[model samples]
Target: MAQGKLERTGFWPGDARLVISISMQFEAGAQPERGASGPFPPLDPKYPDLPMQTWYDYGVKEGIPRMLDLWDRVGVKVTSHMVGQAVDRHPQLAREIVERGHEAAGHGQTWEPQFSMTPAQERAGYLASIASIERATGTRPIGFNAFWLRGTPNTLGILQELGFVYHIDDISRDEPFTVPVNGKPFMVVPYTLRNNDIVRYDSPALTVDAYLADLKAEFDLLYQEAGRRRRMMSISTHDRISGTPARVRALETFIRYAQSHPGVRFMRKDEIARFALTAPGVPRS
Candidate 1:
């Protein structure tokens, strides 16, 4: 199979050597009680997992605010992938995310999977999420990310119909690309798991220092490569994960390190999508 690549002639705006996109996931209180448990045995749906619930609660009560402060102090903007129900539960925090110069993109109505839903159910979920985010933030989210990065075959078509301009579920490329959905161009800003905080759980032996080292290594290579072709480095953080003090400190360090280099810019996913729409050679197979 042939692979599609963004044109090397010119890529990001201002001829930047590299663009770094930060994703702050806000889905703590919106998660299903049984999904993604932490250090707890399986419990019946009839019973609530109190500890797990409160663990997620920490993200709301502490994580989001700490992360917001970090972004404010560092003078960088990020995209917050917010769950609709989560935003509804804390509209004030959602508003603050937008007020602090961050983009609020849709994650879903809740933290449950949408892939199993029928097309009608999926469409309804998308509609509900769009309404919730718009109601809270006063700006309709034009980008969508599915729960657990899982989406059904009908996901793109439904998102396009609902007026979303882009999605980040795709991880096939480092740069944003366009895919034809419903016979029109829809953008895909590829996400990353390599630089994601979830890896800490995926590999319990990993330390925060190791994680920071990985981020720097990834950035170093991409920054070097971007001299010839456009490159974008995506760092994924969650309110329950990277929003903690130690992890967020590592994140702050990485951001400042990136800033030290010339011609590197931090961009929101929407900004990347809009640029991909106009850039040449951004079509994917």
Candidate 2:
């Protein structure tokens, strides 16, 4: 029940601080494929808006555990956006998440599309995703991050109606904001594509050094500006992309380097949302 006020709205962080929230989207085989051999069936472009990975074949079987090990080695807890289809394929993955002490929230049942759908369609998609996650994990997912970047009208309302605590579909700005959903300011944890390792997907060299340098630069700037701005840095990652050995090595180095700075707190999105609800203007817990 910890809540923080927004600097512009009411509260402001007096301390110069930064929160590092790492988002690792766990899809065993949920990534969309450009070819027919995309690991799973064809991507669902209609209601669910699913990706092209054979989630069950890859993620649950080998992907999640591997990523978990990487996080564990670094002593970092991730906010894993669980894809339901993969969950159904690898049910014990949920148990493992709970056992390992990470937050398992919704990434949609199958990592599908709900952003451009009609209100009813979007609502249906949300509900279906939520139920599937809850049934499989025994913990109702409260955080949602859509597969595609698209967000729809009434999305927050629907999320709150279904008892979600936070959502990360928007990147309109760099900082977290509150949406007045259902009369209360529901938490919006801002996510960014910059800190993600996916940026290296099309790069020429595709080396971990590039990723580390970029991540270090972002954290360095944010850490220095801790006084002027209440900041949180999020690194968006995936199994097939960031889960690889090279990227993980880069991530490990950056995490250690960032931790060297004083007052850099690392927590899940739920923890940030809880803090935001209580201490809006404050730098962070």
Candidate 3:
């Protein structure tokens, strides 16, 4: 029903196209230990360092280049959800994303937890993070995706207050939809737990075949749905996993397959947001 409602939106006027968005989480200013308490630590043993030097190196040096190659091949662009400090540290990389034509949005100062913060503190944290990103790249982020998928209850209003167009904080569905702000609609493009590589860290060895198989199934299912009505799908990859040689092959396969497909359009998060807002017969309610 939601997909049917969204399908009325014009896509290439006739044929279906896929718009792919690549969101990279750049968490350089890490405070994994911030939540520690009097007798214990915040970053429990279970949540060991998610972004270590090895992971960072894979993202910046090796994986980004491969991702760029895939983008070039597909004629798709990314909307990098960079951590504030990552932008500061990776000015050249940030410039390159903008230099080529992708949007550079905020991820956060560090991949620190945010769910427990007070509303005021959360707003302050957000502003400070955005300021850091802007200071480094000279461009303010128009979108927001909080680090570690964490946020405050007052997240949406605060984002509006800060002039953000949309946020990827909600992972309720696969399709791009909108949320209400004072009865004014805003985008809530979907994200996922099953569609991410983070699962690899949780259990089992992640292989290229497994990743591509997951992607292939999702794409096929969504593509099939396009025959009846319009649909959108999303997948996220990390440099640490995707950039790794073991997983990179699967990524390459998935990208190439999507590129070769005739009906899909690769686009960024903002593009989908704009489409949802203006598409005919669609409910921006």
**Most accurate candidate by lDDT:** 1
In model 3, where do residues sit more than 4 Å from their true spots? 1-17, 28-52, 283-285
Tens-place lDDT per residue, model 3, 1-285, is: 575445432443345555455665554334343332221223555555443444455677877667666666667787778876666667787777777777777776666667887878778877887887777667888788876677877888888888888888776665666778867777776666676776543446656677688888888877766655546677776654565666666766787787777767867787777776766544453
Which model scores highest in TM-score?
1
**Candidate 1 residue lDDT tens string, 158-187:** 999888999999899888888899888899
Model 1, position 75, has a per-residue lDDT of 88
Whichever of 2 and 3 has more TM-score, that candidate is 3
Number of clashing residue pairs, candidate 1 = 0
lDDT of each: 0.87, 0.71, 0.68
lDDT of 2 by residue, 37-74 (tens): 23345544543433534433444556566778877887
Candidate 1 differs from the real structure by a C-alpha RMSD in angstroms, to one decimal, of 3.8
lDDT (0-100) at residue 280 of candidate 3? 58
Q: Please say which candidate is ahead in lDDT: 2 or 3.
A: 2
Model 1 stretches astray by more than 4 angstroms: 1-9, 34-36, 44-46
RMSD of candidate 3 to the true fold? 5.0
